[model samples]
Target: MHRIRLLTLILCAALAATLLTSVTARADAHPRETGRTVSGPGTPRAEVGLDPATGTPTLAVTRQGRTVLEPSPLGIVTERADLSTGLTLTGRTDREINEHYTTAAGKDRTRSVRMHEARFRFRSTATGARLDLTVRVSRDGVAYRYTLPATSGNVLGETSAFTLPGDAAAWLGAYRKDNENLFNGYGATAAPTGEYMMQGLFRTGSGDGADYALIAESDLSGSYAAAHLTHTAGSPTYGIKLWDGTPIQTSGTGTLTTPWRAVITGDLATVTQSTFTDDLAPASRVRDTSWIKPGKALWTWLAGGRAAGQSLEMQKGYVDYAAARHWPYTVVDAGWYFDPAQWDVTDPDWQQNSWIPELVRYGRERGVGIHVWIHHRDLDTPEEREQWLPTLEKWGVKGVKIDFMDSESQATFQWYDQILAATAAHHLLVNFHGSTIPKGLQRTWPQVMSFEGVNGEEKKTNTPQHLATLPFTRNVLGSMDFTPGAFHKPDRPNAGSDAGELGLTVLYESGIQNLSGKPGSYDARPVARTFLEQLPNAWDETRLLAGAPGESAVEARRSGSRWFIGGTYAGAARTAAVPLTIGHGTWLVETVTDTPAGLVRTPHVVRGGATLSVDVVANGGFAAVACRWYAGRTDC
Candidate 1:
């Protein structure tokens, strides 16, 4: 029996050793077979690895043992060479980036970030052109950009593509020059064939129920035109589509670089919390951002009720409304500078509509600033900008809302840079209307208050589902000028509960929070009035407590010691579980939600870490504020 047992043990040891050798051999050969890889630092590790199966450089990303981004093609196509295929890796370098940064406008004010970056240098076997592909992997996402020799000839476009899983669910917006389209969900295979905007968020359903990938671009410069995604029916791959024009001429010295193509991944919380796009953006160029202040503004374009036109009397009345609500600015929208009949800036009688100076003076005395509007056609040329910008400054105009710049060509981006610089020089805030989606330009020019790249309250398309989707998609990129607060009946044509409209002030983050409701409308509801009065335009901290794109969204934000929570739901009536994890303390919780009678405010007391059951009606919303409660009075 002893002899037999010893023989069995020896046989088992040898078999185990053989299996270990086989596994070791496979692990050792992985780099040579699959190419190079760099992994992010944290739980649910994220890795970007090169695939060289087709003798061309391709990239794939995986997190927590699931594919976030499948093997997709990568290269820059220029007139001199088709560098998309037949590439050989020549050299590679890896590094770690760990830093902390702050932003003037975003979901949160500060961020501490760490990422793993790798530069894989490849030589095109076809033309011998060297292409440097830089891949950076953060804890929650991945970003990459391409760099090529300037002499590579005129750049036609790129071959970079994203191939998602066919089973994955995607929320996409069709391409629009102004980026004012609504998002709709579709299967990756069933996605419509056409150009899509910068943002497209996908759900991988990777068991943890939080796996998502958001496609976006960052650090856009004037030298390169912005890119949109082009999809073909029945295919899961989306390729890069440039503006409708000829190839960009090869100029300048050294190397030409493309903007960072970023994919924010992970669960909903990680996707919302990841500031990777802004992290990839260039650092701020403004020396003194103190003059750039963020606050609420009264806009008279959409929700002015009877007083819609931009006459001097109407402007002063809106300014009075802004002052009464403690809102700092009132935007006198279009028709302010041009003649009502001609709508021309060069009209000899344009100077006749010159109550702007008097209105500015009137607003200044009452502690309200005025922002005038101008048509982009009238302000595109350098000569026109120089002529009108200084005159508006001389009139003490606080800002300019320039509209109808509905293109993202290279020249248009150059114009944007020029206008931002000119406005900065004059210390004038800028709100771009009918513009492309923001790509972290606010960091470079702090004076840029907002961008109307969304189908906001100005349109009846601001449905509940659309509003619920913005936070996870477009608003995640940067400040969105959603122009919330359409509480009145006739203006609120879309299907949403009154509480949802009130909650938008907290749900959307804009440097200039444009309040669109009339004075009488807000006066009737003291609860909403008081809520708006205390809400801050900027936040010290933000969290996506519980949310899913399109279906529902619930967020909690902090401004100093007080915590504000907003929830928006679509589809059907349900109770949302809001976990009050503000801190360990007794607190006073005041909630504004829709009841059968109307919008009402309710207050209660609860300890930290307790869950608050918020009943959100179908296609409705809710807003709440929590503060430390002590003695007989609330700390808030």
Candidate 2:
């Protein structure tokens, strides 16, 4: 009887200890499992949990019961620990954020942002290293990032990936430093094994053409390099692949905050009109942005005027053209300071040059600003910028087009911030060329007018499908320096119609619309000039009325009381019925359409909410101007 009692006591003690260990483990892994699901302001939902089979952290998003993103993997890969697996969710927190602000450029003037945020803190069970995964879900999309504890370590890469539905359609572009790769359509599972650059758009549902998700990143500071997406053969997952560079290191003091790996979701209109990319970025760092003006400019490079390198006569002609058209600026492109006689001596003391200051003075007199191009290598460091930027500002140069950066590494990203800060100090606007896609930096620095990261007119291989894909993919992120409107130029053979070329002026949103046509080209096309004269670089409101990724695109933008509609179609000919949702009023409509004879302009009147039907030919386009009809006169 003593032996039996002793055995029973030992067994009971063992059972009690096992139960306590199990309870403690569960509590450490999921302290607040009940708050795993987060719902946005609308139908968007983000569910965070561990994969039962793999024991890895997972994130899934949905809209109106439709899966916008499949259960995607989420974790960080550090040098000292494998945080992707063997992780324990030590804690969790939730909150809501609401903000309203005005923007200097891009899709909307006034932005209202509301987001539901959740932070999941985890500890590596093996190494005991801590990481916090923060997620924010807005009405239009979902974004998340990893935050590491202040420890001296190197972040190798991310294990986070975007898993697409098997049947989803994707429009993606190959990774390029200039981001000038061509976008092509493909099945989600068949995405190229190579790599794809940012702002990729995917169609989640085939029904109603309403569901879409744009994959992008925001707040990409200097701590980490920009990453692209890579797919495995036959897999629906696109994993993160960082650019070749040094691993992100922490100094054991300040916490390392990674960029937000964002996936924007909703209907086509929601995807196109969404400022969620800008919403995810930091607020404007330049407090006094009043001097940062957005307007149209004349670019002489594409017009073969670069051959007249530094010629005062050639520049004055272009400046006079800008002044005549009421345009705000003229860009003096490359070769402005190149000593043609001494081709080897590339870097010269441009301040001592006579023509640049004269051109600046001449442009200022005619209400036109001069923007000069400088190679990124020339103004690379802080010392170089301090020496050159102040002199350029003193010379009355309004903005600088910094070109040939050609990098997306950590160092390059840091360089971009430094340059923007330096230019803001000098009160000069900026346009970035040979650069990565806009990671919502324009919102932080309003002086950053646009980025030449698209296969714009500079590339002759651009097609109608490429043009149609832009409003959905690239332009949605921010201003695109497309350098459009080069109609009737023999050397510049556009694949789309002349009317389509005209439509680009309104469709692509660039803070500075560098018109590519020379003076004679615009003079030759009167109808195109008429449309350009009224086009505004910045808009009060913008809407994607009707379209699809590659098949077609129609957009409407408003500036004050006037509204402009632009449409482009690929593949077969179709009559686009665009809903003019410019509020209640009689609108005086003037449209530039492609006809059997040539480009034609017609005038009529229509009530608001009426459908403006346009017959777009295969690879053709059209543009229209609508103003409130007040007592037989238009309020334009």
Span of 10 residues, lowest total lDDT, candidate 1? 43-52
Clashing pairs in 2: none
Taking the tens digit of each residue's C-alpha lDDT, what string does model 2 give over 1-636? 999999999999999999998776554344354467777558489888785555589899989998888889998887787788888777767778889988888878999999988788888777888888888999888999888877737888888899988888899998887899878899988876878887788888776745899999999877788988888768888898778645876676888989999988998888899888789999999999889899999998987666745688899988898999999999988887676553333346545645788999999999999999989998998877887799889999999999999989888888987998899999999999998878889888899999999998888677777888999999999999999888745433234477878888888998988999878888877888978998986899998878888878888899987888888888777777878777887888888887778778887687888888777777888888888786767435
Residue range 233-293, candidate 1, lDDT tens digits: 8998988887774586557476888889988988888888777787777777878778787
Task: Please give the RMSD of candidate 1 to the true structure.
Answer: 9.5
Q: After superposition, how far is residue 327 of candidate 1 from its true place, in Å?
A: 0.6
Q: Over 4 Å off in model 1, which ranges?
A: 1-35, 43-53, 206-209, 305-309, 340-353, 489-496
Which candidate has the top score in lDDT? 2
- Please report, in order, the local distance difference test score of every candidate based on alpha carbons: 0.81, 0.84
